[model samples]
Target: MEAAIRASQAQLFEAQAQLTKSQADWERAQNLMQANSLTQPDFDSAKLALATAQGKVKEAEQQVRVNNGKLTESKANVLAARARVDQSQGQVDASVAQENRSQAGVDSARSRTVGARSNVEQANVALGDIFLKAPMDGVILTRSVEVGAQVGPGTVGFAMADTHHVLVTFGVPDILVRDLKLGQRLDIKCEALPGRTFEGTVRTVAPEADADSRVYKVEVRVDNSKDVLKVGMIASLDLVDKEDSPRSIIAVPLGALMPNKDQEDAYQVYVIKDNKAKLRDVTVGRASGDMMEITSGLEEGEQIVVEGGNRVNDGQTVKVKS
Candidate 1:
Protein backbone atom coordinates (compact mmCIF):
# COMPACT_ATOMS: atom_id res chain seq x y z
CA MET A 1 0.00 0.00 0.00
CA GLU A 2 2.83 2.36 0.87
CA ALA A 3 4.50 1.69 -2.45
CA ALA A 4 1.26 2.23 -4.37
CA ILE A 5 0.72 5.53 -2.57
CA ARG A 6 4.25 6.63 -3.39
CA ALA A 7 3.91 5.74 -7.07
CA SER A 8 0.62 7.65 -7.40
CA GLN A 9 2.12 10.69 -5.68
CA ALA A 10 5.10 10.65 -8.04
CA GLN A 11 2.93 10.44 -11.15
CA LEU A 12 0.70 13.31 -9.92
CA PHE A 13 3.63 15.65 -9.22
CA GLU A 14 5.28 14.90 -12.55
CA ALA A 15 2.04 15.53 -14.45
CA GLN A 16 1.30 18.76 -12.56
CA ALA A 17 4.76 20.11 -13.36
CA GLN A 18 4.26 19.26 -17.02
CA LEU A 19 0.82 20.86 -17.13
CA THR A 20 2.16 24.11 -15.62
CA LYS A 21 4.92 24.25 -18.20
CA SER A 22 2.64 23.48 -21.13
CA GLN A 23 0.13 26.12 -20.07
CA ALA A 24 2.89 28.72 -19.89
CA ASP A 25 4.20 27.75 -23.32
CA TRP A 26 0.74 27.89 -24.81
CA GLU A 27 0.16 31.34 -23.33
CA ARG A 28 3.50 32.54 -24.68
CA ALA A 29 2.66 31.19 -28.11
CA GLN A 30 -0.68 32.96 -28.02
CA ASN A 31 1.07 36.27 -27.28
CA LEU A 32 3.71 35.68 -29.94
CA MET A 33 1.11 34.77 -32.60
CA GLN A 34 -0.86 37.97 -31.80
CA ALA A 35 2.34 39.96 -32.19
CA ASN A 36 3.02 38.20 -35.56
CA SER A 37 6.33 36.92 -34.16
CA LEU A 38 5.53 33.18 -34.21
CA THR A 39 4.75 31.06 -37.28
CA GLN A 40 1.31 29.39 -37.60
CA PRO A 41 2.78 25.86 -37.26
CA ASP A 42 4.68 26.74 -34.04
CA PHE A 43 1.60 28.27 -32.47
CA ASP A 44 -0.48 25.24 -33.44
CA SER A 45 2.05 22.91 -31.86
CA ALA A 46 1.96 24.86 -28.62
CA LYS A 47 -1.82 24.82 -28.60
CA LEU A 48 -1.85 21.05 -29.07
CA ALA A 49 0.70 20.58 -26.26
CA LEU A 50 -1.47 22.58 -23.88
CA ALA A 51 -4.52 20.44 -24.66
CA THR A 52 -2.54 17.25 -24.10
CA ALA A 53 -1.29 18.54 -20.74
CA GLN A 54 -4.84 19.35 -19.67
CA GLY A 55 -5.95 15.80 -20.50
CA LYS A 56 -3.03 14.36 -18.51
CA VAL A 57 -3.95 16.42 -15.46
CA LYS A 58 -7.50 15.10 -15.56
CA GLU A 59 -6.25 11.53 -15.91
CA ALA A 60 -3.93 11.93 -12.93
CA GLU A 61 -6.78 13.19 -10.76
CA GLN A 62 -8.89 10.17 -11.69
CA GLN A 63 -6.03 7.82 -10.82
CA VAL A 64 -5.72 9.39 -7.37
CA ARG A 65 -9.40 8.77 -6.68
CA VAL A 66 -9.17 5.17 -7.83
CA ASN A 67 -6.07 4.52 -5.72
CA ASN A 68 -7.69 5.99 -2.62
CA GLY A 69 -10.66 3.62 -2.97
CA LYS A 70 -8.37 0.60 -3.37
CA LEU A 71 -6.37 1.60 -0.29
CA THR A 72 -9.57 1.72 1.71
CA GLU A 73 -10.69 -1.71 0.43
CA SER A 74 -7.32 -3.29 1.23
CA LYS A 75 -7.48 -1.95 4.78
CA ALA A 76 -10.95 -3.41 5.26
CA ASN A 77 -9.75 -6.79 3.96
CA VAL A 78 -6.92 -6.81 6.49
CA LEU A 79 -9.41 -6.28 9.28
CA ALA A 80 -11.59 -9.14 8.00
CA ALA A 81 -8.58 -11.43 7.84
CA ARG A 82 -7.77 -10.74 11.49
CA ALA A 83 -11.34 -11.53 12.46
CA ARG A 84 -11.19 -14.88 10.61
CA VAL A 85 -7.98 -15.78 12.42
CA ASP A 86 -9.54 -15.06 15.78
CA GLN A 87 -12.64 -17.13 14.96
CA SER A 88 -10.49 -20.10 13.88
CA GLN A 89 -8.52 -19.94 17.14
CA GLY A 90 -11.75 -20.01 19.12
CA GLN A 91 -12.93 -23.10 17.24
CA VAL A 92 -9.65 -24.89 18.00
CA ASP A 93 -9.99 -24.13 21.71
CA ALA A 94 -13.60 -25.37 21.81
CA SER A 95 -12.62 -28.63 20.10
CA VAL A 96 -9.85 -29.25 22.68
CA ALA A 97 -12.29 -28.71 25.58
CA GLN A 98 -14.79 -31.16 24.05
CA GLU A 99 -12.08 -33.84 23.67
CA ASN A 100 -10.98 -33.48 27.34
CA ARG A 101 -14.60 -34.04 28.65
CA SER A 102 -15.30 -37.24 26.65
CA GLN A 103 -13.58 -40.25 28.25
CA ALA A 104 -15.94 -42.95 26.83
CA GLY A 105 -15.79 -41.42 23.33
CA VAL A 106 -12.04 -40.75 23.47
CA ASP A 107 -11.17 -41.93 19.92
CA SER A 108 -14.10 -40.09 18.30
CA ALA A 109 -13.42 -36.90 20.29
CA ARG A 110 -9.68 -37.15 19.45
CA SER A 111 -10.48 -37.41 15.71
CA ARG A 112 -12.73 -34.31 15.87
CA THR A 113 -10.05 -32.36 17.76
CA VAL A 114 -7.43 -33.24 15.10
CA GLY A 115 -9.77 -32.15 12.33
CA ALA A 116 -10.50 -28.88 14.12
CA ARG A 117 -6.76 -28.15 14.53
CA SER A 118 -6.23 -28.84 10.81
CA ASN A 119 -9.06 -26.41 10.03
CA VAL A 120 -7.35 -23.76 12.17
CA GLU A 121 -4.16 -24.16 10.13
CA GLN A 122 -6.13 -23.98 6.89
CA ALA A 123 -7.94 -20.88 8.14
CA ASN A 124 -4.57 -19.23 8.88
CA VAL A 125 -3.45 -19.90 5.30
CA ALA A 126 -6.70 -18.49 3.95
CA LEU A 127 -6.31 -15.45 6.17
CA GLY A 128 -2.85 -14.85 4.76
CA ASP A 129 -4.19 -14.93 1.20
CA ILE A 130 -6.90 -12.38 2.04
CA PHE A 131 -4.31 -9.64 2.69
CA LEU A 132 -4.25 -8.63 -1.02
CA LYS A 133 -1.28 -6.35 -0.53
CA ALA A 134 0.03 -4.52 -3.58
CA PRO A 135 3.64 -4.91 -4.69
CA MET A 136 3.74 -1.12 -4.75
CA ASP A 137 0.99 1.31 -3.72
CA GLY A 138 -1.23 2.16 -6.72
CA VAL A 139 -4.78 2.43 -7.99
CA ILE A 140 -6.75 -0.64 -8.82
CA LEU A 141 -7.23 -0.11 -12.54
CA THR A 142 -9.68 -2.99 -12.89
CA ARG A 143 -11.88 -4.88 -10.46
CA SER A 144 -13.15 -8.26 -11.73
CA VAL A 145 -15.42 -9.24 -8.87
CA GLU A 146 -18.44 -7.90 -7.01
CA VAL A 147 -19.26 -8.13 -3.33
CA GLY A 148 -20.19 -11.72 -2.27
CA ALA A 149 -18.78 -13.15 -5.50
CA GLN A 150 -17.30 -16.62 -5.28
CA VAL A 151 -13.51 -16.80 -5.76
CA GLY A 152 -10.96 -19.59 -5.81
CA PRO A 153 -7.31 -20.32 -6.43
CA GLY A 154 -5.88 -18.38 -9.39
CA THR A 155 -8.85 -16.01 -9.34
CA VAL A 156 -7.85 -12.46 -10.16
CA GLY A 157 -10.26 -10.23 -8.23
CA PHE A 158 -8.68 -6.93 -9.06
CA ALA A 159 -5.72 -5.21 -10.70
CA MET A 160 -3.70 -3.07 -8.32
CA ALA A 161 -1.57 -0.06 -9.33
CA ASP A 162 0.79 2.22 -7.46
CA THR A 163 0.19 5.65 -8.91
CA HIS A 164 0.99 7.85 -5.87
CA HIS A 165 4.56 6.95 -6.57
CA VAL A 166 4.95 6.03 -10.22
CA LEU A 167 7.74 4.59 -12.29
CA VAL A 168 8.54 6.70 -15.37
CA THR A 169 10.34 4.39 -17.76
CA PHE A 170 12.24 5.81 -20.73
CA GLY A 171 14.99 4.69 -23.05
CA VAL A 172 18.33 6.34 -22.37
CA PRO A 173 21.51 6.09 -24.39
CA ASP A 174 23.70 3.23 -23.20
CA ILE A 175 26.51 5.64 -22.30
CA LEU A 176 24.18 7.78 -20.21
CA VAL A 177 22.90 4.79 -18.27
CA ARG A 178 26.44 4.15 -17.00
CA ASP A 179 26.41 7.47 -15.14
CA LEU A 180 23.06 6.77 -13.42
CA LYS A 181 22.66 5.17 -10.00
CA LEU A 182 19.82 3.96 -7.81
CA GLY A 183 18.31 6.52 -5.36
CA GLN A 184 19.70 9.50 -7.31
CA ARG A 185 17.17 12.32 -7.77
CA LEU A 186 16.71 13.69 -11.31
CA ASP A 187 14.97 16.72 -12.71
CA ILE A 188 12.29 15.95 -15.28
CA LYS A 189 10.05 18.03 -17.54
CA CYS A 190 7.09 17.15 -19.71
CA GLU A 191 6.73 18.69 -23.16
CA ALA A 192 2.96 18.66 -22.80
CA LEU A 193 3.35 20.66 -19.57
CA PRO A 194 5.93 23.16 -20.74
CA GLY A 195 7.31 25.42 -18.02
CA ARG A 196 7.05 23.21 -14.93
CA THR A 197 9.75 20.83 -13.70
CA PHE A 198 9.52 17.84 -11.30
CA GLU A 199 11.99 15.74 -9.35
CA GLY A 200 12.24 11.94 -9.73
CA THR A 201 14.38 9.26 -8.13
CA VAL A 202 16.26 6.82 -10.31
CA ARG A 203 14.75 3.47 -9.30
CA THR A 204 16.15 1.10 -11.91
CA VAL A 205 18.70 1.13 -14.74
CA ALA A 206 18.50 -1.75 -17.18
CA PRO A 207 21.73 -3.67 -17.59
CA GLU A 208 21.26 -4.16 -21.33
CA ALA A 209 20.26 -1.82 -24.11
CA ASP A 210 17.70 -2.64 -26.78
CA ALA A 211 19.44 -4.12 -29.79
CA ASP A 212 17.73 -1.88 -32.38
CA SER A 213 17.34 1.35 -30.35
CA ARG A 214 20.77 1.03 -28.68
CA VAL A 215 19.18 2.68 -25.62
CA TYR A 216 18.73 1.23 -22.15
CA LYS A 217 15.43 1.39 -20.33
CA VAL A 218 15.68 3.52 -17.19
CA GLU A 219 12.87 3.86 -14.63
CA VAL A 220 12.49 6.87 -12.37
CA ARG A 221 10.04 7.03 -9.46
CA VAL A 222 8.22 10.29 -8.72
CA ASP A 223 5.97 11.36 -5.85
CA ASN A 224 2.55 12.66 -6.95
CA SER A 225 0.43 13.23 -3.83
CA LYS A 226 -0.37 16.70 -5.13
CA ASP A 227 -2.26 14.98 -8.01
CA VAL A 228 -0.39 16.84 -10.73
CA LEU A 229 1.43 13.96 -12.50
CA LYS A 230 -0.12 11.10 -14.48
CA VAL A 231 0.99 7.68 -15.68
CA GLY A 232 2.26 7.51 -19.29
CA MET A 233 2.87 11.26 -19.53
CA ILE A 234 5.92 11.93 -21.74
CA ALA A 235 8.76 13.49 -19.75
CA SER A 236 12.32 14.72 -20.35
CA LEU A 237 14.67 13.50 -17.61
CA ASP A 238 17.94 15.08 -16.46
CA LEU A 239 20.33 14.35 -13.61
CA VAL A 240 20.44 16.92 -10.82
CA ASP A 241 24.20 17.05 -10.25
CA LYS A 242 23.86 18.90 -6.96
CA GLU A 243 21.54 18.14 -4.06
CA ASP A 244 19.73 20.82 -2.07
CA SER A 245 18.35 20.61 1.45
CA PRO A 246 14.59 20.31 1.80
CA ARG A 247 12.43 22.99 3.42
CA SER A 248 9.03 22.80 5.11
CA ILE A 249 6.44 25.54 4.73
CA ILE A 250 2.75 26.12 5.34
CA ALA A 251 0.77 26.29 2.10
CA VAL A 252 -2.82 26.50 0.91
CA PRO A 253 -4.71 25.88 -2.29
CA LEU A 254 -4.68 28.65 -4.88
CA GLY A 255 -8.43 29.11 -4.45
CA ALA A 256 -7.81 30.02 -0.82
CA LEU A 257 -5.82 33.11 -1.84
CA MET A 258 -7.73 36.06 -3.20
CA PRO A 259 -6.43 39.18 -4.94
CA ASN A 260 -6.02 42.22 -2.66
CA LYS A 261 -7.90 45.16 -4.19
CA ASP A 262 -6.15 47.81 -2.08
CA GLN A 263 -2.61 46.76 -2.97
CA GLU A 264 -1.60 45.55 -6.41
CA ASP A 265 0.73 42.50 -6.55
CA ALA A 266 -0.58 41.44 -3.15
CA TYR A 267 -2.98 38.72 -2.02
CA GLN A 268 -5.34 38.20 0.92
CA VAL A 269 -6.91 35.17 2.56
CA TYR A 270 -10.13 35.25 4.57
CA VAL A 271 -9.26 33.43 7.73
CA ILE A 272 -12.11 32.40 10.02
CA LYS A 273 -11.16 34.17 13.19
CA ASP A 274 -13.73 33.94 16.00
CA ASN A 275 -16.30 32.77 13.44
CA LYS A 276 -15.85 35.90 11.33
CA ALA A 277 -13.96 36.59 8.10
CA LYS A 278 -10.69 38.33 9.01
CA LEU A 279 -9.14 39.28 5.70
CA ARG A 280 -5.39 39.84 5.83
CA ASP A 281 -2.69 40.51 3.23
CA VAL A 282 -0.37 37.60 2.66
CA THR A 283 3.04 37.01 1.06
CA VAL A 284 3.13 34.11 -1.41
CA GLY A 285 6.01 31.89 -2.48
CA ARG A 286 6.39 29.09 -5.07
CA ALA A 287 3.23 27.74 -6.70
CA SER A 288 2.85 24.03 -7.55
CA GLY A 289 -0.19 22.62 -9.31
CA ASP A 290 -3.07 24.01 -7.21
CA MET A 291 -1.18 24.82 -4.01
CA MET A 292 0.69 28.03 -3.20
CA GLU A 293 3.19 28.10 -0.35
CA ILE A 294 2.50 30.80 2.24
CA THR A 295 5.78 32.61 2.81
CA SER A 296 4.91 35.01 5.66
CA GLY A 297 1.19 35.78 5.77
CA LEU A 298 -0.65 32.72 7.04
CA GLU A 299 0.05 30.67 10.13
CA GLU A 300 -0.46 26.96 10.69
CA GLY A 301 -3.84 25.68 12.03
CA GLU A 302 -5.74 28.71 10.72
CA GLN A 303 -8.80 28.12 8.55
CA ILE A 304 -8.67 30.05 5.30
CA VAL A 305 -11.53 30.74 2.96
CA VAL A 306 -11.59 28.39 0.00
CA GLU A 307 -14.98 29.21 -1.48
CA GLY A 308 -17.44 32.12 -1.36
CA GLY A 309 -14.77 34.53 -0.15
CA ASN A 310 -15.95 37.25 -2.51
CA ARG A 311 -19.40 37.27 -0.91
CA VAL A 312 -18.14 38.53 2.43
CA ASN A 313 -16.21 41.57 3.65
CA ASP A 314 -13.48 41.93 6.26
CA GLY A 315 -14.82 41.19 9.78
CA GLN A 316 -18.12 40.03 8.27
CA THR A 317 -19.89 37.19 10.05
CA VAL A 318 -19.85 34.00 8.01
CA LYS A 319 -21.03 30.45 8.41
CA VAL A 320 -18.97 27.56 7.09
CA LYS A 321 -20.60 25.45 4.44
CA SER A 322 -21.51 21.95 5.52
Candidate 2:
Protein backbone atom coordinates (compact mmCIF):
# COMPACT_ATOMS: atom_id res chain seq x y z
CA MET A 1 0.00 0.00 0.00
CA GLU A 2 2.90 2.39 0.76
CA ALA A 3 4.45 1.57 -2.56
CA ALA A 4 1.22 2.39 -4.37
CA ILE A 5 0.93 5.69 -2.44
CA ARG A 6 4.57 6.64 -3.35
CA ALA A 7 3.93 5.91 -7.04
CA SER A 8 0.77 8.05 -6.98
CA GLN A 9 2.62 11.01 -5.33
CA ALA A 10 5.38 10.82 -7.98
CA GLN A 11 2.75 10.88 -10.76
CA LEU A 12 1.12 13.96 -9.08
CA PHE A 13 4.40 15.80 -9.00
CA GLU A 14 5.07 15.10 -12.71
CA ALA A 15 1.58 16.31 -13.63
CA GLN A 16 2.02 19.55 -11.63
CA ALA A 17 5.32 20.25 -13.37
CA GLN A 18 3.70 19.78 -16.77
CA LEU A 19 0.80 22.07 -15.72
CA THR A 20 3.24 24.89 -14.83
CA LYS A 21 5.00 24.67 -18.16
CA SER A 22 1.69 24.61 -20.04
CA GLN A 23 0.39 27.74 -18.20
CA ALA A 24 3.53 29.62 -19.14
CA ASP A 25 3.21 28.62 -22.75
CA TRP A 26 -0.50 29.57 -22.87
CA GLU A 27 0.17 33.08 -21.47
CA ARG A 28 2.92 33.80 -24.04
CA ALA A 29 0.70 32.56 -26.85
CA GLN A 30 -2.23 34.81 -25.72
CA ASN A 31 -0.03 37.90 -25.66
CA LEU A 32 1.38 37.15 -29.11
CA MET A 33 -2.15 36.60 -30.43
CA GLN A 34 -3.25 39.96 -29.00
CA ALA A 35 -0.25 41.67 -30.68
CA ASN A 36 -1.11 39.78 -33.89
CA SER A 37 2.26 37.92 -33.65
CA LEU A 38 0.69 34.39 -33.04
CA THR A 39 -2.12 32.73 -35.07
CA GLN A 40 -5.56 31.73 -33.57
CA PRO A 41 -4.89 27.99 -34.11
CA ASP A 42 -1.57 28.10 -32.26
CA PHE A 43 -3.14 30.08 -29.39
CA ASP A 44 -5.99 27.46 -29.09
CA SER A 45 -3.35 24.65 -29.12
CA ALA A 46 -1.47 26.12 -26.08
CA LYS A 47 -4.78 26.65 -24.18
CA LEU A 48 -5.79 22.99 -24.83
CA ALA A 49 -2.38 21.71 -23.67
CA LEU A 50 -2.79 23.68 -20.37
CA ALA A 51 -6.30 22.25 -19.86
CA THR A 52 -5.11 18.64 -20.43
CA ALA A 53 -2.23 19.06 -17.91
CA GLN A 54 -4.68 20.46 -15.29
CA GLY A 55 -7.01 17.41 -15.76
CA LYS A 56 -4.09 14.91 -15.40
CA VAL A 57 -3.00 16.67 -12.15
CA LYS A 58 -6.54 16.31 -10.76
CA GLU A 59 -6.62 12.54 -11.68
CA ALA A 60 -3.20 11.87 -10.04
CA GLU A 61 -4.27 13.71 -6.87
CA GLN A 62 -7.46 11.62 -6.70
CA GLN A 63 -5.40 8.39 -7.06
CA VAL A 64 -3.10 9.57 -4.22
CA ARG A 65 -6.20 10.03 -1.97
CA VAL A 66 -7.49 6.54 -2.89
CA ASN A 67 -4.08 4.96 -2.16
CA ASN A 68 -3.86 6.70 1.22
CA GLY A 69 -7.35 5.40 2.21
CA LYS A 70 -6.31 1.85 1.31
CA LEU A 71 -3.11 2.18 3.38
CA THR A 72 -5.13 3.32 6.42
CA GLU A 73 -7.50 0.34 6.03
CA SER A 74 -4.55 -2.08 5.87
CA LYS A 75 -3.12 -0.61 9.09
CA ALA A 76 -6.53 -1.02 10.80
CA ASN A 77 -6.58 -4.69 9.71
CA VAL A 78 -3.11 -5.23 11.23
CA LEU A 79 -4.26 -3.72 14.54
CA ALA A 80 -7.31 -5.98 14.61
CA ALA A 81 -5.15 -9.07 14.06
CA ARG A 82 -2.84 -8.03 16.94
CA ALA A 83 -5.89 -7.58 19.22
CA ARG A 84 -7.11 -11.07 18.37
CA VAL A 85 -3.69 -12.55 19.15
CA ASP A 86 -3.59 -10.79 22.53
CA GLN A 87 -7.06 -12.05 23.42
CA SER A 88 -6.12 -15.66 22.54
CA GLN A 89 -2.96 -15.43 24.64
CA GLY A 90 -4.96 -14.15 27.60
CA GLN A 91 -7.38 -17.09 27.35
CA VAL A 92 -4.51 -19.60 27.24
CA ASP A 93 -2.96 -18.10 30.36
CA ALA A 94 -6.27 -18.27 32.21
CA SER A 95 -6.70 -21.94 31.27
CA VAL A 96 -3.22 -22.79 32.50
CA ALA A 97 -3.84 -21.06 35.83
CA GLN A 98 -7.11 -22.92 36.26
CA GLU A 99 -5.44 -26.27 35.61
CA ASN A 100 -2.75 -25.55 38.20
CA ARG A 101 -5.38 -24.66 40.77
CA SER A 102 -7.31 -27.87 40.08
CA GLN A 103 -4.15 -29.95 40.46
CA ALA A 104 -3.34 -28.29 43.75
CA GLY A 105 -6.84 -29.03 45.03
CA VAL A 106 -6.49 -32.70 44.06
CA ASP A 107 -3.14 -33.01 45.82
CA SER A 108 -4.53 -31.40 48.94
CA ALA A 109 -7.47 -33.81 48.99
CA ARG A 110 -5.12 -36.79 48.64
CA SER A 111 -3.06 -35.63 51.58
CA ARG A 112 -6.16 -35.26 53.69
CA THR A 113 -7.31 -38.76 52.75
CA VAL A 114 -4.01 -40.22 53.84
CA GLY A 115 -4.15 -38.39 57.13
CA ALA A 116 -7.72 -39.57 57.72
CA ARG A 117 -6.77 -43.19 57.09
CA SER A 118 -3.88 -42.96 59.54
CA ASN A 119 -6.20 -41.49 62.14
CA VAL A 120 -8.67 -44.32 61.63
CA GLU A 121 -5.98 -46.97 62.11
CA GLN A 122 -4.72 -45.28 65.25
CA ALA A 123 -8.27 -45.05 66.60
CA ASN A 124 -8.80 -48.77 65.99
CA VAL A 125 -5.66 -49.63 67.94
CA ALA A 126 -6.74 -47.41 70.81
CA LEU A 127 -10.17 -49.01 70.89
CA GLY A 128 -8.61 -52.45 71.00
CA ASP A 129 -6.43 -51.39 73.93
CA ILE A 130 -9.41 -49.95 75.78
CA PHE A 131 -11.24 -53.28 76.07
CA LEU A 132 -9.96 -56.45 77.73
CA LYS A 133 -10.76 -59.85 76.20
CA ALA A 134 -10.45 -62.96 78.32
CA PRO A 135 -8.15 -65.65 76.93
CA MET A 136 -10.74 -68.33 77.53
CA ASP A 137 -14.33 -68.71 78.77
CA GLY A 138 -14.29 -67.81 82.45
CA VAL A 139 -15.80 -65.70 85.21
CA ILE A 140 -14.19 -62.51 86.39
CA LEU A 141 -13.35 -62.90 90.00
CA THR A 142 -12.00 -59.40 90.65
CA ARG A 143 -11.92 -56.07 88.82
CA SER A 144 -9.17 -53.70 89.89
CA VAL A 145 -10.33 -50.64 87.98
CA GLU A 146 -13.69 -48.89 88.16
CA VAL A 147 -15.54 -47.49 85.18
CA GLY A 148 -13.91 -44.35 83.67
CA ALA A 149 -10.69 -45.10 85.53
CA GLN A 150 -7.43 -44.52 83.68
CA VAL A 151 -5.25 -47.57 83.19
CA GLY A 152 -1.85 -47.82 81.56
CA PRO A 153 0.42 -50.60 80.54
CA GLY A 154 0.65 -53.65 82.83
CA THR A 155 -2.41 -52.57 84.73
CA VAL A 156 -4.24 -55.42 86.42
CA GLY A 157 -7.70 -54.70 85.15
CA PHE A 158 -9.37 -57.99 86.09
CA ALA A 159 -8.67 -61.34 87.69
CA MET A 160 -10.38 -64.25 85.93
CA ALA A 161 -10.64 -67.98 86.52
CA ASP A 162 -11.73 -70.59 84.00
CA THR A 163 -14.50 -72.58 85.66
CA HIS A 164 -15.05 -74.89 82.70
CA HIS A 165 -11.90 -76.90 83.41
CA VAL A 166 -9.86 -76.80 86.59
CA LEU A 167 -6.13 -77.51 86.64
CA VAL A 168 -4.50 -79.20 89.68
CA THR A 169 -0.70 -79.38 89.89
CA PHE A 170 0.96 -81.77 92.38
CA GLY A 171 4.44 -83.17 93.00
CA VAL A 172 5.24 -86.85 93.06
CA PRO A 173 8.38 -88.92 93.67
CA ASP A 174 10.35 -90.26 90.70
CA ILE A 175 9.38 -93.81 91.62
CA LEU A 176 5.70 -92.84 91.46
CA VAL A 177 6.21 -90.95 88.19
CA ARG A 178 7.20 -94.19 86.47
CA ASP A 179 3.70 -95.46 87.07
CA LEU A 180 1.92 -92.21 86.13
CA LYS A 181 0.89 -91.77 82.49
CA LEU A 182 -1.14 -89.35 80.46
CA GLY A 183 -4.95 -89.73 80.56
CA GLN A 184 -4.87 -91.57 83.91
CA ARG A 185 -7.93 -90.94 86.07
CA LEU A 186 -7.52 -89.89 89.71
CA ASP A 187 -9.93 -89.09 92.50
CA ILE A 188 -9.71 -85.41 93.53
CA LYS A 189 -10.97 -84.39 97.00
CA CYS A 190 -11.30 -80.73 98.04
CA GLU A 191 -11.27 -79.94 101.71
CA ALA A 192 -13.77 -77.09 101.27
CA LEU A 193 -16.26 -79.21 99.35
CA PRO A 194 -17.13 -82.01 101.69
CA GLY A 195 -18.36 -85.39 100.32
CA ARG A 196 -17.74 -84.22 96.76
CA THR A 197 -15.07 -86.18 94.84
CA PHE A 198 -14.15 -84.71 91.42
CA GLU A 199 -12.68 -87.21 88.98
CA GLY A 200 -9.60 -85.70 87.22
CA THR A 201 -7.56 -86.89 84.26
CA VAL A 202 -3.77 -86.80 84.20
CA ARG A 203 -2.63 -84.30 81.55
CA THR A 204 1.17 -84.08 81.96
CA VAL A 205 3.97 -85.72 83.98
CA ALA A 206 7.34 -83.95 84.31
CA PRO A 207 10.16 -85.43 82.29
CA GLU A 208 12.83 -84.20 84.77
CA ALA A 209 12.97 -84.38 88.53
CA ASP A 210 13.02 -81.27 90.72
CA ALA A 211 16.38 -80.62 92.39
CA ASP A 212 15.03 -79.44 95.73
CA SER A 213 12.33 -82.04 96.40
CA ARG A 214 13.54 -84.78 94.07
CA VAL A 215 9.95 -85.01 92.81
CA TYR A 216 8.25 -84.66 89.42
CA LYS A 217 5.37 -82.27 88.71
CA VAL A 218 2.09 -83.75 87.53
CA GLU A 219 -0.83 -81.81 86.02
CA VAL A 220 -4.44 -82.91 86.31
CA ARG A 221 -7.38 -81.57 84.35
CA VAL A 222 -10.71 -81.82 86.10
CA ASP A 223 -14.12 -80.99 84.65
CA ASN A 224 -15.87 -78.37 86.72
CA SER A 225 -18.81 -77.63 84.49
CA LYS A 226 -21.01 -77.25 87.57
CA ASP A 227 -18.67 -74.55 88.92
CA VAL A 228 -18.37 -76.44 92.21
CA LEU A 229 -14.56 -76.19 92.44
CA LYS A 230 -13.22 -72.85 93.61
CA VAL A 231 -9.84 -71.36 92.82
CA GLY A 232 -7.07 -71.45 95.54
CA MET A 233 -8.85 -74.25 97.42
CA ILE A 234 -6.91 -77.07 99.06
CA ALA A 235 -7.38 -80.30 97.11
CA SER A 236 -6.00 -83.81 97.42
CA LEU A 237 -5.86 -86.59 94.86
CA ASP A 238 -5.28 -90.35 95.28
CA LEU A 239 -3.30 -92.36 92.73
CA VAL A 240 -4.74 -95.87 92.63
CA ASP A 241 -4.25 -98.35 89.81
CA LYS A 242 -7.50 -99.99 88.70
CA GLU A 243 -5.86 -103.39 88.35
CA ASP A 244 -8.96 -105.42 89.26
CA SER A 245 -10.97 -103.73 86.48
CA PRO A 246 -8.27 -103.60 83.80
CA ARG A 247 -9.00 -101.73 80.52
CA SER A 248 -7.47 -104.54 78.39
CA ILE A 249 -5.02 -102.10 76.71
CA ILE A 250 -1.96 -103.05 74.61
CA ALA A 251 1.15 -102.85 76.76
CA VAL A 252 4.77 -102.55 75.53
CA PRO A 253 8.12 -102.48 77.33
CA LEU A 254 9.40 -99.03 78.29
CA GLY A 255 12.52 -99.57 76.16
CA ALA A 256 10.46 -99.88 72.96
CA LEU A 257 9.06 -96.30 73.24
CA MET A 258 10.93 -93.31 71.88
CA PRO A 259 10.00 -89.64 72.01
CA ASN A 260 8.72 -88.49 68.63
CA LYS A 261 11.07 -85.87 67.27
CA ASP A 262 8.42 -83.87 65.44
CA GLN A 263 5.82 -83.68 68.19
CA GLU A 264 5.87 -82.63 71.84
CA ASP A 265 4.77 -85.12 74.52
CA ALA A 266 4.35 -87.74 71.80
CA TYR A 267 5.85 -91.23 71.61
CA GLN A 268 6.70 -93.52 68.70
CA VAL A 269 7.55 -97.22 68.59
CA TYR A 270 8.97 -99.58 65.95
CA VAL A 271 6.84 -102.53 64.87
CA ILE A 272 8.39 -105.60 63.21
CA LYS A 273 6.48 -106.50 60.03
CA ASP A 274 7.87 -109.03 57.52
CA ASN A 275 11.34 -108.57 59.13
CA LYS A 276 11.25 -104.78 58.63
CA ALA A 277 11.12 -102.26 61.46
CA LYS A 278 8.30 -99.83 60.68
CA LEU A 279 7.98 -96.80 62.98
CA ARG A 280 4.46 -96.06 64.33
CA ASP A 281 3.07 -93.10 66.23
CA VAL A 282 1.08 -94.14 69.31
CA THR A 283 -0.95 -92.45 72.04
CA VAL A 284 0.00 -93.72 75.48
CA GLY A 285 -2.13 -94.17 78.63
CA ARG A 286 -1.18 -95.15 82.20
CA ALA A 287 2.19 -96.78 82.80
CA SER A 288 2.41 -99.63 85.34
CA GLY A 289 5.86 -100.80 86.41
CA ASP A 290 8.22 -101.34 83.43
CA MET A 291 5.32 -101.67 80.95
CA MET A 292 3.65 -98.70 79.15
CA GLU A 293 0.15 -98.83 77.65
CA ILE A 294 -0.11 -98.24 73.89
CA THR A 295 -3.63 -96.86 73.51
CA SER A 296 -3.42 -96.75 69.69
CA GLY A 297 -1.26 -97.43 66.56
CA LEU A 298 -0.21 -100.96 67.56
CA GLU A 299 -1.84 -104.42 67.10
CA GLU A 300 -1.93 -106.95 69.91
CA GLY A 301 0.09 -109.61 68.04
CA GLU A 302 2.73 -107.26 66.53
CA GLN A 303 6.39 -107.66 67.62
CA ILE A 304 8.44 -104.58 68.64
CA VAL A 305 12.01 -103.77 69.51
CA VAL A 306 12.60 -103.71 73.28
CA GLU A 307 16.42 -103.60 73.71
CA GLY A 308 18.80 -101.60 71.54
CA GLY A 309 15.77 -99.94 69.92
CA ASN A 310 17.57 -96.56 69.54
CA ARG A 311 20.07 -98.07 67.08
CA VAL A 312 17.31 -99.01 64.60
CA ASN A 313 15.69 -96.75 62.02
CA ASP A 314 12.36 -96.85 60.24
CA GLY A 315 12.02 -99.35 57.36
CA GLN A 316 15.25 -101.15 58.34
CA THR A 317 15.79 -104.92 58.13
CA VAL A 318 15.70 -106.54 61.55
CA LYS A 319 16.02 -110.02 63.05
CA VAL A 320 13.56 -111.18 65.69
CA LYS A 321 14.87 -113.26 68.56
CA SER A 322 13.43 -116.78 68.84
In model 2, the clashing pairs are: none
Clashes of each: 43, 0
Question: Which residues of candidate 2, in runs, are more than 4 Å off?
Answer: 1-102, 113-121, 139-161, 173-178, 207-215, 240-322
Per-residue lDDT over 210-252 for candidate 1, one digit per residue giving the tens place of the 0 to 100 score: 6544557788888888767776565665532234356677988
Task: Write the residue-wise lDDT of candidate 2 on 75-154 in tens digits.
Answer: 66556555555555555455556765666555655555555555555544543443345688887789697534677889
**How many clashing pairs in candidate 1?**
43
